[model samples]
Target: MPGKLTITRKISYDTFVQVMEKKGAPDSLAENIIAQRKYTLSKLDRRFVKELLFGSLRWYAKLYWILQKTSNRDLDKVTAQIKTALILGSYQIFYMSKVPDRSAVNESVEYIRYAGQANAVKFVNGILRTISRRAEYFPKPDKNKHPSQYLALQYAHPKWLVDRWSKRFNFERLKIILNANNQQAPNTIRVNSQKVPAHDLLNFKQSILREDKNTVYNKSLATCLVLKDSPNLEIGSQFAEGKYTIQDGSSQLVGHLVQPKEGEYIIDACVGPGGKSGHIVELSKGKAKVTAVDFSLAQINKAKTNLLRLGHDKIEFVCQDFLDFTPTQKPDKILLDAPCSGLGVLRKHPEGKWLKSPRIVHNMARRQQALLKHSLQILKDGGEIIYSVCSFEEEETIKQKEWLEREYKDAVSFPELSTRLPENYKYLLTKENILLILPGNKYSMDGFGAFIIRKNESVSNCRQAK
Candidate 1:
């Protein structure tokens, strides 16, 4: 019953594979997203192609499971184009209800030919057509026989991750988390109040736009807006004018936590594309001096471009690994937005689940620990460090926090964040009161976790200030 793969000489998922393979390469996700902007595809074509690319990767595990059963061959034995086509075709047939089944199959068959695998036309067609009919029979991992396997194949996640989350969350919540991750996140951007308030852009007569009430949970964000629908619009109208930048609302919260004061000095570690670093400058009313550092020169250049567009000319841009780069001046505050498994923003980048593993998480946690040690050394005494990651993995989050607390028992402690969040979103806090935002939590926002730690400060003083 294995689906047959015809070896062909054509390339497929060219863009998707290129982006996916760049996993830990110099350019990060934000950089890739920006690079994608240069593509000449129309809005409709771009959306469709991107959806297929990201969607196929997001559902890769389940697709491979289905393919193995259908083809009777190891997935690796299949030609790359055939495999990519099958995955793309299956994703549309199963997950993309908006797409017509016949069209999905036809396009895939044609795609194989376009990939120069003319001989594979029938094989790709047959498997997709057969799958279209037996879709319900696939992804049927029995719950009673194998609960972890059930969640893994059914939810399209690595079995190890599902197992960990299964133990961490109740069954229902885990399902919600997985299902939310599968859904497309709305396109949201933070309007630059320093240049233009979000309200002024509303009904500005350039393009159709709507303000989603749930885009942001915090009133102080002041610049968040969710795009109602993907429409062809002029980048010159607003973005080119430095009126706003594409940033997730979840990311905007760290700026609020930063609470940068006018003329204060701040350092943004791993500040790629400069989204948060720009937010910090905006929050400080353009008075704060931000020193943004990144390990990649490419990312630093990209961040510099975005910063320039945001009217920032004087912010220091350092291209050096945070661990090796010594600061010329101690920062009054620092945002160690340390990179991790990216488990939290899976909804935004579902390819992560397919490309990441437990070993990667462990290694990253160790690396993050070293970065934290170095950051602490450069941090001025009594200055605050907003430690954060776009992931909920214990190795990258709570355990990391515990590590910091343990190693610096006499030197550091977390500040109370409950008072920092709106009353409705206060539930985002953990039992330890650490901020751990989950996917599809009240705001339908991306999952993010952050903890504010103030050095050389008493717990009582921090609590009182909060």
Candidate 2:
């Protein structure tokens, strides 16, 4: 009877714990997995769960501080499941006006019982009920005394991230950046220009083809489209016919910077999962000879699959690291889309905000520098190399650009990209005139830092001198 009762009552709670175990204790993961499970959650119920998970995780430190003040025992000594239940229940009581106090207390008590802790059910119920009744009496810290703490609690970010941004960016800009990361990322797709023209794709409209029928579609830009939601575009005939490829708006800008001409030969170093590499082939109108290289055979196979599905035969994918791969013919241009801490695209991948550290940025900067140096060697005389990273961190972006300037000196020329930028984005140009895109900008481009460097003719000639 106990086993049967447990099975019936614990199914949803067990699924939540399983998701937390697999995806870590991040609130977003919990919410996503729960929603995807199709567990009869009403919209309101789902919203409350999401807020509880994300809000608790976001301000976990402050919540733990509050818990410490209330209890005599160390918070860490508390069982993981019990702590999670408390956080969830406490969040509901404190934040969710729609969630009844009795439901929060009863459900949490049931959750503890389901976790094989029937002894702690009364404790759980009592604590949640007490907190619910005296919620206003909880000590609230003054924002003026601890601005970082206040922001950490309010926005649900770590104090360290808040402190880092406070020093690096102005308060207002940092607030905007943090707020953007907390929000859901819009789904943007890039038109497969080789197969479908942007204008034709946008003009041809059908209900099933539309991501959001209510949202207006723009046709002029070949680079990107921000959809209201992730559509079942894969099932659509247009997508099956290779009309477009899903890519972040900021990533679409990388192809624009590469500026692959119709007949030029281009090397896409570090091409993996082939989104941008495929975009390059599409942008070049199937006229450019593309050598897409990656370190992993698995990714090379994936690129091959994508190319095959799209009916592309012009692009050659090499399953070899760029550092070791030897090309039979020199490329007219090279695009080094180097790997780095993905700090810039945090809005799209909120999980990354917690995963990345400052040291990872430094390590990535070193790897990027090495890749850039090698890219210069492979590039042809007077060829262009676009160094790009999906990171706004100075160590990887501005600092890397500065290092390139000092190292290459007159060997490279930074292009005036502002002249070519979409009118809405002319102001993001750096002093030396490189393009640095931030989120919430006029262009709504994902945060990015790219440098379009043209190899000096004199430098190529000097190599000939040697």
Clashes of each: 7, 1
lDDT of 2 by residue, 1-466 (tens): 1222222123334434554456444544544555666556544455455455555444445555555666556767777777766766676676668778877777777788777888877677777777778654555556778877777666666677778778888767877877776665665677676665655654544432454242424523555665554444444455566656667766776787787788899998988777878877877777788999999997888788777667676788887878887688777888888998877776655445555565788799889888877777777778888888887778887788788778777787778787656665567777866677766665556788888878775444443211
Q: In candidate 1, which residue ranges exceed 4 Å CA deviation?
A: 1-12, 17-39, 135-139, 197-221, 231-233, 457-466
Residue 459 deviation, candidate 1, in Å?
A: 17
What number of backbone clashes does candidate 1 have, counting pairs of residues 3 or more apart or in separate chains? 7
Cα deviation of 449, candidate 1, in Å: 1.0
For candidate 1, the per-residue lDDT at 450 reads 87
Using TM-score as the measure, which candidate wins? 1
Q: What does candidate 2 score on TM?
A: 0.79
Q: List lDDT for all candidates, in order.
A: 0.75, 0.68
Q: List the pairs of residues colliding in candidate 2.
A: 58-156
Residue 32, model 2, lDDT: 53
